[model samples]
Target: MSRSSRVVFYSLSRKFVQEKQAPPKAQEVIYYSLAIGHHLGVIDCLQSRLECPLDGFNRWVAQLPSGGAARRKLEGLGRFGEICIDSTHTHLLATALSKAAPLLTDEQQSWSQRLIDLLQLIENEPAIYLMVRRRDG
Candidate 1:
């Protein structure tokens, strides 16, 4: 999270995006993970907003108090592993993923806006809230 780290992550993320031949799904997963912390943060956020308990509410809630740092660490390592998984694969992905790490803030902001919008809908719509709660509660 230092200035240098941001530079490195942004550089690598841009590199990955530049590769025309990398698989779209793989690239998306990497970028999404970088942006979303493997959806762990998203899940935690959603869990908190819901009136009803999700299936893993207990487990998820437990993890939330710990912060997303550990999840981000594991996710970061996983990203590196993805880049290195295939020896035959092009190195573009690896390089992009490394430099792209810093772009996470951008993704987080985008997702935050989206979550805000969605939460607003949830707040205004009794039907949706009931649906989420009746099904989930």
Candidate 2:
């Protein structure tokens, strides 16, 4: 992603935090797609240390408006997508998650920490890996 892309993402995340309203469907799709892509990357990077199940990941993905299609795309990947999310992006996401944590239901809160941890891990690591799925004919 370019510098501008990062700025756009950070700006969008900050907006999400401040407004406490869901972005439009298009923005939501982009936001969650990038967020989940980065998350899956973090999980893959820390595979030995983490135990993120696909079912759980899918559940989170299902939160998106187009979640069913997103989950199908993820399933097609057959493995982690390789993408990178910088610390700035990760930090913004972490902040957003933390601020929203208190409002989450018990079940949602259970996995929230895992999400926070992954975001924090990206900060410590020199580089964070994220993935984008590709389709082959």
Candidate 3:
């Protein structure tokens, strides 16, 4: 990205981090990440939020720490091969799945599956689908 773009991303990232405590921008981050096809960014943002559950109206927001000096560090989930998600993350992931399921194309499904599997959900597992059902039911 250009120098100005970097400044804007950092500025927005900080604003969202703060907003997460009050107004919450978690879903926006998800949609943006998805729109840009930044799969790793999607997972990182989602995982961070799962790690630190927000409260109040902004409860949906996850708290991701500020990225380091290297600009690329902020763009994707580094070392994704070693990532793991706990029960809370699984629950959140399922929620995201349900919301995005209808709009997701086959190619996007392939991308979504990576995030799902990173959270340890097996492909085409009947039990995993139950999580979304439980939420919608």
Candidate 4:
């Protein structure tokens, strides 16, 4: 980006980062709105420069940090990855299952189950000795 654009982005970023806290619900709305605004600005800038509306929000979602105590609580379960991907998919899916299940799907689910079964089988198998010489033998 040019120096002026970089300066504006940094200024806006600092404004959002340094804002005063609000009540729980208000805080959520405030931060989310700011994040959406930032994302839009980024998308517009990138599209203008690249000559395409870059459809990489999935990649962006993966790289965004999970913020706040609530985020930690949600992530404590194995739900964060599932929820994050689901949320990101909502923005791009627009009714396409392929886009919706980029990382999870029916066939992949079956494959994952089969792989788990194989792992269990391997875990239950007895060890085999190849070559050994015991001094006491």
Highest lDDT among the candidates is held by which one? 2
Error of 2 at 31 (Å): 32
Query: Residues 1-137, candidate 1, lDDT per residue (tens digit)?
Result: 22222101100111122334557667666566445442332221223232212323222223322344333432333235211111221232233333434543554434324333443443454222111221311
What are the per-residue Cα lDDT tens digits for candidate 4 across 2-44? 2221100000113243345567777667656655654523211
Ranking according to TM-score, highest score first = 2, 3, 1, 4
**What C-alpha lDDT does candidate 3 achieve relative to the native structure?**
0.31
**Separate clash counts for every candidate:** 9, 5, 1, 0
Q: Would you list the C-alpha lDDT of every candidate in the order shown?
A: 0.30, 0.43, 0.31, 0.28
Q: Tens digit of lDDT per residue, candidate 3, span 1-137?
A: 22221111100112122232323656666545544543434322321221211121011211122232221221222222122333445545545654655556564455445545544542333222111100010
Each candidate structure's TM-score, on Cα atoms with residue i matched to residue i, is 0.22, 0.37, 0.26, 0.19
RMSD (Cα, Å) for all candidates, in order, is 20.1, 17.2, 19.9, 23.7
Which pairs clash in the backbone of model 2? 81-131, 82-130, 82-131, 83-130, 83-131
| Per-residue lDDT of 96 in model 3 | 64
What is the alpha-carbon lDDT for the whole of candidate 1? 0.30
How big is the positional error of residue 8 in model 3, measured in Å on the Cα after superposition?
Answer: 21
The candidate scoring highest on TM-score is 2
Stretches off by above 4 angstroms in model 2 are 1-84, 132-137
- Stronger candidate by lDDT (2 vs 4): 2
Query: TM-score of model 2 relative to the true fold?
Result: 0.37
- The sequence of per-residue lDDT tens digits that candidate 2 reaches over residues 1-137 is 22221100011121122234545775666555545553422122222223334444445445433434333433443454322345655655455556656656566565557656666766676355333332222
**Native-to-model Cα distance after best TM-score fit, residue 43 in candidate 1, in Å:** 24
lDDT head-to-head 1 vs 3, winner: 3
